[model samples]
Target: MTSLSKGDKAPEFHGLNQNNETISLETFKGKKIILYFYPKDNTPGCTAESCNLNDNYQAWLAKGYEVVGVSPDSVASHKKFADKFQFGFNLIADTEKEILQAYGVWGEKSMYGKKYMGVMRTTFVINESGIIEDIFEKVDTKNHTDQIIKALDIK
Candidate 1:
């Protein structure tokens, strides 16, 4: 798997959003993108990060950017998570894990010495030109969306 990093052309794919509508990076061409890959939906830290972004969504819009959350979850689960948390952005249902793997966020993770494979909780910031400008390989779930906005200076 090619490690997604700064200067890499953001891997593009067409997938279903929370509503089961198909979308791709091509759809958001000419705009900055926040492609956040978390482990799951409706979980404690994931929900908080998503909700934080939703709370500060207008600021992000004013700065002209789009947020897309991806995980191995299904569309139905994403819909429920979005509805429950009023997530204003698109939650991608990457059931095949293609997107996650493409971004190199799917790998072995160990928790308490029990090694297991799972989503690596990573985030990528693709610029309007479709170049990956920033990559947060290990993200702090608490208030992490703010970190993205700050790192990108989305004022």
Candidate 2:
């Protein structure tokens, strides 16, 4: 649902991570960023996606990429989720949905004919300069890391 596309400047944002520490796009300046947005914490699909990424986090770091996840869940929720899974990356708590809206990932969604506003699952591969190198709208939750590597053609 995001209007942002590849080659666009990724929107700047600042929010509290699961630890309640402030995290901002500025914090990752000059580093390739894997910025991902998800709907909630502790859900099946979200858990699978997050675990897959966390499982391969070291490989991502070795490749010079930092992973960050954003969700509308509260800081407490994020903390629990991250702690339970022992995630090695920052999980930003977008409780106010500010980051979500800025990235255009917050929008109306439907489930079983019921429509509601929620965060749309998305990932933006940002370059060292903060430019979006690729956008993944249709994520493969169980194999997201491999999906990203293949999509970016990373060797």
Candidate 3:
């Protein structure tokens, strides 16, 4: 779980996308950002969440929000996943977990009674001024985009 809260300054982050292109928070300066962190690539929940965003990509863009997903997956894995889903936005390959840690989404999680350290699913809605407007900790995978729309009050 992230210590960050609404109205907090979003942590600066830079990482490579599936295409090996550098992407940073600076890259989206003056634009609203939906930075979502997932555990891995090609998982059921992750896929549903990403696909929901893809389905509403244009709506988000029209509302001036740039959506991006992050995961601790390799560039190659991200490439495959994005290609398979034909996502319209960037998927940052956080192989080093630097961005994940900076966002405070890298932490311990329990699954099936087993506790382990991993990336917790999280989303940060950052305004054009680079301050967090909302944070989504309990994401609804298939309706994730709807959740964002509600959170940001985007018409």
On TM-score, the leading prediction is 2
Predictions in order: lDDT = 0.86, 0.97, 0.92
Sorted by lDDT (best first), the order is: 2, 3, 1
Q: Which 10-residue span in candidate 1 carries the lowest summed lDDT?
A: 146-155
Angstrom error of the Cα, residue 57, model 2: value is 0.2
Report clash pairs, candidate 1: none
lDDT of 2: 0.97
Ten contiguous residues minimizing lDDT sum, candidate 2:
91-100
Model 2 lDDT per residue over 1-155, tens place = 89999999999999999999999999999999999999999999999999999999999999999999999999999999999999999999998899999999999999999999999999999999999999999999999999999999997
What is the alpha-carbon lDDT for the whole of candidate 1?
Answer: 0.86
Residues 1-155, candidate 1, lDDT per residue (tens digit)? 23876899999877999999998999999998888888899899888878887887777778887888999999999999999988899999999999888888889888899999899888888889999999987676777767886777755
The residue pairs found clashing in candidate 2 are none
For 99-134, candidate 3 gives per-residue lDDT tens digits of 999999999999999999999999999999999999
Q: Give model 2 RMSD, 1 decimal.
A: 0.5
